[model samples]
Target: MHIKTRLTILNFLEFFSWGAWLLSAGAYMSTTLGFTGVQIGSVYATLGIASIFMPPVIGIIADRWIPAEKLFGISHLLLAGLFVVLTSMTSFNSFYMVTFLVALVYMPTLALSNSISYYNLEKEGLDSVVTFPPIRVWGTVGFIIAAWLVDVLGLKVSHEQFYLAAAASVLLGGYSFSLPLIPIVKNTSRTLFQRFGLDAFVLFKNKNLAIFLVFSVLLGAALQITNIWGVPFLNDFSISYKDSFVVKHAVFLMSLSQVSEVLFILAIPFFLKRFGIKIVVLISMFAWVFRFGFFGVGSPEGMGLLFLITSMIIYGMAFDFYVISGSLYVDKMSDAKVRSSAQGLFMMMVNGFGAVLGAYISGFVVDYYTANNGIKDWASIWFICAVYALIIGVLFALVFRYKHTGEENLVIKK
Candidate 1:
């Protein structure tokens, strides 16, 4: 089989496994397990906490010793057992501990998957910037399919989602061994600081990378808010605008974001090739402002529907350009020895620190607007988020002044 085809399959199952539970698990805990809001937050916080540190630690191991594909397989194999345990846990304490362990095993695999993909693609003489976005789009498709399946099978609030994920995890675990090996890049003469992730920290010494990473954190906060709130905000219209199709089919409406994602993913190679990393990423930041801007103003009626649809459409550009391109930038910029760790650092900043901040600030925004009677002013909340994105865009444009040479993605410096 072609290497890209094989890797595409791998990417598909990787995200499909995640989509099975990540989105609907809260609904399950809330409705079926009878968990309160705080309890659910505590349980879900496990993922953010695990993302904070695990990726870099595992990346260090992959960089120094075991091949990345081997580590990827081992992580998923462990996840299979963890998910099984998670399926049976009934108490909040036990569930929290077990699910926390689940996150620990699962989170690192995200970085490993990229490391594996980039290494294998280079070995096969393919350019990741040219080839990867297309393959990566399949992962999103797999996620959409998984989410749809969970709903179709009536397992949204059931343990079956975990069960299905476990099955796929085990399959991917075994298949990972068949993938091309990603050799360990180690220096035997390194000092202890250089050996233990201080090396990855050196990436911050580069001014352009430093600025990019900072903005990545701020932009990362914007990334999850739409996914978290879009449906519920649309649901608010279900009563007042019962005749609106979007109100009645909010899940399907939200799915438009993922659909639009595929199109933008295809377009990324063109934009990145022509514009270089700086312009491409700046476009992403601008897209985010518009993404939230549309939401803040749009209603459920005729023109408002266009606003909502436009918001979902731009989601493709907001996420793919910011994240996928950022990963490509990291891959191109870092030393091969520290590549995995560098990718891990990117995951840590965006998914870890950025997400944690977004969660708290978004929660505060929601709570502050929540009337004593429990009503929320979502318009004001989204407007605040839009303003935040606008400020980030303006600051990014003014502050991050990188002129992307056509050679920015010049072959990885050996």
Candidate 2:
């Protein structure tokens, strides 16, 4: 295979593993395990919890000890084993434990994939700005493929999805070994017992960065709310409207969000350059408001379809701007020695601490609003999320001031 083709396949398999379960797991919990909102939150929180320490630590090891490619391979191989175990789990505690273990192996792959891609791109003499987005977009396509497979193959909310995910992960794990070796270099000149990628901690010292990280945690809370509840929400509509198309194809329908993510990502350079990162991100924040609020008010019926479409469209901004743009912003500002660590730090806030906190709390809120018979109060749940996102958006606008530089300005309009 051509190097780009090899890398593209790598991207596809990497996200396909996630696509198998991430979006559809809500329905599995709600319909299969009969878990409450808090229970769901706890499960999703495992991703956040693992992300907090795992990514940076593993990154440090990759930088200083083992080849990153080897570590990446090992992580996915571990996840493949865990996914098999997860398929056998029938209880919440057992399942949560297994999922947590799976997360420790899986979540960091997100960061690792980027690291690998960045290294490869630079090696090939391609600008990440121009090349990475196209490659990264395939990951979303992989996600869509996974969702379709689960839906069409009738694996929704079943162990089969995990089996499929396991197979892909194993394939990717072995394939990782074929890529270029990422060497680990020891730094004998360093001090004792400092945290892995600790330079990210200094971001706390910058006022704007402190606020950004703070809001990142808060917004990160809003990020997973839909994933934990949306499928089940659509499924609930199935209970009353059994023949509704939404129920029949809920996972496939939700995949639209991922599909939309590609287009939104393409728009990022324009938004970033034209308006600057601050406004671009703020627009993304408000986009989250629309994302959740539409769900609160929308239905499978006529104009509700518009609302649903709007929500999906806005999701591109809500997700891409904060994550991709935020990463780039950090890159533009940080020095080379600590750049990787800084990126890991931003992820720790958004995906690690933020996601964990969101999942745990959302579970409580979602379950609390759910009635005695166990039907989720999706409207109320979405409403709460909409409000949370709105508040965060408002606060972000008030804080974190920055004027776009000339170089960044050129990048955007180009």
Best of the candidates, lDDT: 1
Candidate 2 vs. true structure, TM-score: 0.94
Per-candidate local distance difference test: 0.81, 0.80
Extract clashing residue pairs from model 1: none
Could you tell me the C-alpha RMSD of candidate 1 in Å?
2.5
lDDT by residue (tens digit), candidate 1, 1-414: 989998999999998888777766765775578664456656665666787898888889899888889899988989988888888887888888998999889988888888888888888999888999999999888877877777667676688789888988999999999998777865674689876755887788788888988887888788867655665567667557878876555555666777788899899888987888888888998899889889988888888889989998998999899889999888888877787898998888777667666756776776688678656688898889989998998898888878766665533443
Tell me, by TM-score, which candidate is best. Answer: 2
Tens digits of per-residue lDDT, candidate 2, 328-410, equal 67655554445446666777788899898788888888778878987768888888888888888888888788787636522
Worst 10 residues of 2 by lDDT: 405-414
TM-score of every model? 0.91, 0.94
Q: Cα RMSDs of all predictions?
A: 2.5, 3.0
